[model samples]
Target: MLMTERRAVVTGGCKGIGAAIATRLEADGLSVVRADLPAAAGAWRAGGGTAVDVDVSDTRSVDAMIAAAVGLLGGLDVMVNNAGVAEQRARVDAMPDSDWDRVISVNLGGAFRCTRAAFDHLRASGHGAVVSLSSTWGLGGVPGYAAYCASKAGIIGLTRAMAADGGPFNIRVNAVSPGYVANDMGGSLDGLDAEAAARAWAGRDLQASFQPLGRQCDVAEIAAAVSFLVSDQASFVTGTVLPVDGGQSNRLNTGEQQWPAP
Candidate 1:
């Protein structure tokens, strides 16, 4: 069976990679429910996915969102742990405990909450899959992104642990680590309209110069990978950090080499 046919819930599904995951899942024939911040309902529904206002970090909201999604889709086969919050750039020395906690709560705690809430529905369905969104920055150092890095890195660890826990029940857990995607948090493009950001990344082609792919990846590509990981086709796959990045994580995009001096 393809992805769209499955009943899936994607948190943070109103925009960016979360939206892309929900869209791709829908394309694959899966009924999709998108749990996003309240303001995103109109946009989520407009895309043919059911939208619910949810703060994945909150236990009550997480429970409600999962229940609502199960109600809307008739049961759950997949849960994409894609909702996340990133902290502002700050020196590690100066980063507040609140900042660290906030990042941890949303990125790591949200995944825990959502997965916990959806466990029964997923297990009963027999092919329960959980795919989380992670970042290459989580694997390595990026100046000014200490808190963000810690949170995402924690996700990778959590994914592995979940895989072990869910294996007995036949639920597979995996994560996708994205690098240099043209999004507000992922690349040089911040606060720009999505179209402009896409154009700039594709037009500039800086991703390959250092990333090995020489291009920024669109959200769809990563979503497709996530979809595959959750699909039956990957039945044997579990407890992996699948890097959707074009090897950029291996070679940090340091700077342009000025071989030709002025």
Candidate 2:
């Protein structure tokens, strides 16, 4: 299908990585509909994209958002399930049930609701694609992100299952797992004092040593990956988890190892 003839819906499309994906899709010549919280309506309008107020955790809201997207765009060709939330740093034992439930509901459950709502339109398009955001933390465990990790991991599983189900309709489903990108969510040095923040930022060299690429992923880089997965080039690509995490997923931390004079 031609880019100009495509229509896409991106949840959480008002800021951060979501905004980047929406912008990339728009640049690719697709009519983009950005569905975010009502508070983000202004940002979405400022970006000159059609905005829909949506709370992915709410079934009624999700259905309304999908209906609006389809109505506005005439049909849906791509669905980007980018809406998600993270809990404050806490171990599973210490975490509140509300925190866990909220994270799962918005991150994993939201993707499921959005995907299900868009299924018919996607199937009708015959060249439809869905890309859900997963995280590198989802692939492995992080010390204090139990809820967030579980939700993202669930998205990966859901993506695979949806791929199998959507295959008959020629709809592609995939997940993009991004490593730490410098965004509000990833770059947060929250709760740290100025000195601590500075020290942490200065220790980027040490942090980079743990990952093969020696740097954090960028929002645009991740968006580029999404662009490909939703485009004709990746027509044959589905039921796969693409990691854009600078090799963080496969890296092993050896901790301060030095070569003796190579």
What's the lDDT for all of these models? 0.85, 0.89
Deviating ranges (above 4 Å) for candidate 2:
46-48, 186-209, 257-262
lDDT of 1 by residue, 1-262 (tens): 4755579999888888888888898888889888998878777577665799899778999999998889888999999998887777888998899988888999999999999999998899888999998888899888887888988998999999999999998999999999877564433477678998788766546544566665677889999899899888899999999998888776745587424434
Q: Against the hidden reference, what TM-scores do the models get?
A: 0.87, 0.91
Q: In terms of TM-score, which candidate is strongest?
A: 2
Residue 216 shift from truth in candidate 1, angstroms = 0.9
Misplaced by over 4 Å in model 1 are 1-5, 46-49, 185-208, 252-262
**Distance (Å) between predicted and true CA of 1, model 1?**
5.4
Worst 10 residues of 2 by lDDT: 253-262
Model 2 RMSD, rounded to 1 decimal? 2.5
TM-score, cand. 1 vs. native: 0.87
